[model samples]
Target: MINWKYCIIGAALVVVLGMLFRMMFEYGVLIGILIPGVIVGYLVNNGYKNGAKNGIITGIIGGFIQGILVYITIDLNLPPFPAVISYILVFALFTTATSAFLDAVGGIIGALIRDKI
Candidate 1:
């Protein structure tokens, strides 16, 4: 069974940290990959599969929320609001799809390290 609690927790953390890193550094995506892993690190005890699930859910949810937040906070300078929204959504979907795998890999690696210790 999937652990929604950990997923939500990881999502919340990744969203916050991801935004901050995006503003402060050039390595946002690279660092963001680890946020989910760190947030779900405790679940390593549950196994790599569980860790991966939690991380992917976190990435999906967090990516969407971040997308919405970006839409609200930044002006795309597009003439049509709908166009801006659609572009934001498209980019969000792409970002989520790309990041999900990295997050799962990070989760699995975290779990392996935890398991070994």
Candidate 2:
């Protein structure tokens, strides 16, 4: 059986790392969304055998929400509609890709440590 608690813990850690990456790299537009998506993906993949779909959906939703918050947090002044739309697209794409990748990575890692876990 897989350990979901550990997966959650890993996801949490990844979130923090993502925040740090944003702050350090000064990522624009998408990384913030991508980070949360990746975290969700990591957790879902580790939690279940057929979790890829769930992970992708969860990551997309999580990333979108996180991206909205991050956008608000970063930009005090509201921009134009085009800018907002662009931001949304960039964020969605980043989250979708990053989360999918993280899901695969987490799955592999979980499998490797299954016995120890």
Candidate 3:
């Protein structure tokens, strides 16, 4: 019962809005992730039975995509070979985890609100 459409939309929002905020303001990373996380949380809560799971999936997809984009744009230029791969993996993991946690929290909150209403 995973809703692919909402997941894709959430990912798209994360990428587009994440980039937009990154370019226009300070604390862009946080703000970028927050907006999309909240949106995804709300959307996921509409159909998903488990808010945490839905949020985690949405966050992973969106965060990983955003992480790749950021990685490509930033161009850390780490030493070639294994080092580069390691760096990418670490960065991707960090970004994905951070976003997932934040989005999960938002999703939980959204679910609570939905339940209350």
lDDT of 2: 0.50
Cα displacement (angstroms), candidate 2, residue 72, comes to 2.8
The residue-by-residue lDDT of candidate 1 on 26-114, one tens digit each, is 87855865767655855746788887887787778877777667555666466577887688888778767655766777678777878
**lDDT tens digits, residues 18-105, model 3?**
7888899987876777666566556666633466666777779988888878876888565888877777778878888887887777
What does candidate 2's lDDT look like per residue over 13-102, in tens digits? 445555567677766323533444344444444443534444444444445444555566667776798998788678656764665565
Model 3 accuracy (lDDT, Cα): 0.73
What is the TM-score (0 to 1) of candidate 1? 0.84
Give the clash count for model 1.
0
Superposing all C-alpha atoms, what RMSD in Å does each candidate have to the true structure? 2.0, 5.7, 2.5
Off by over 4 Å in 3: 46-49, 76-78, 113-117
